[model samples]
Target: MPRMKVLLISLAFVAIIGSLGAALYFMMKDSGDKPKSSHMARALAFRVGFSILLFVCILVAWKLGYLRPTGIPLQG
Candidate 1:
């Protein structure tokens, strides 16, 4: 894989982790034993969006001939 693709994939992963951490932090920061549903929802949305973005990136890479399938060879 190229450097740009690697960088993007890593950044996406980091963003997803950050969102999750933020959600956890907000959930734990509340008093009165109430969870922050808004933060959790936003984090969830971010994660989903990032996942879709990653999927699109992969699809684009494949379409652009940057990715290829590798497996055992078949003989007939």
Candidate 2:
């Protein structure tokens, strides 16, 4: 289960990064006298939406006991 969760989250991150890369590519490709393009904006919007969905999924998983938070130990 933990492995599945990790895989799913990793895939989501990859998709998010891919969307970001697409946005950057479109931005650079459309940078010459064509009015601002919508492709970049759409890609960015997809990235934002995907990010929110990922966050919500993680939150729900934690609430349903499929995930737990872990990090560096507190010095206190």
Best by TM-score: 2
lDDT of 1 at 48: 84
Candidate 2, residues 1-76, lDDT tens digits: the string is 7888889999999999999999898888845755446788999999999999999999998999888778887898
Q: lDDT per model, in order?
A: 0.81, 0.90
Off by over 4 Å in 1: 33-35, 70-76
Model 1 backbone overlap count: 0
TM-score of each: 0.73, 0.83
Q: For model 1, what is the error of residue 25's alpha carbon versus the real structure, in angstroms, after optimal superposition?
A: 1.3
| Pairs of colliding residues, candidate 2 | none
TM-score of 2: 0.83
Write model 1 residue lDDT over 1-76, tens digit each, in one string: 4787778888989998898888777777756553577777788788889889888988988899987666788988
Model 2 error, position 9 (Å): 0.1
Clashing pairs in 1: none
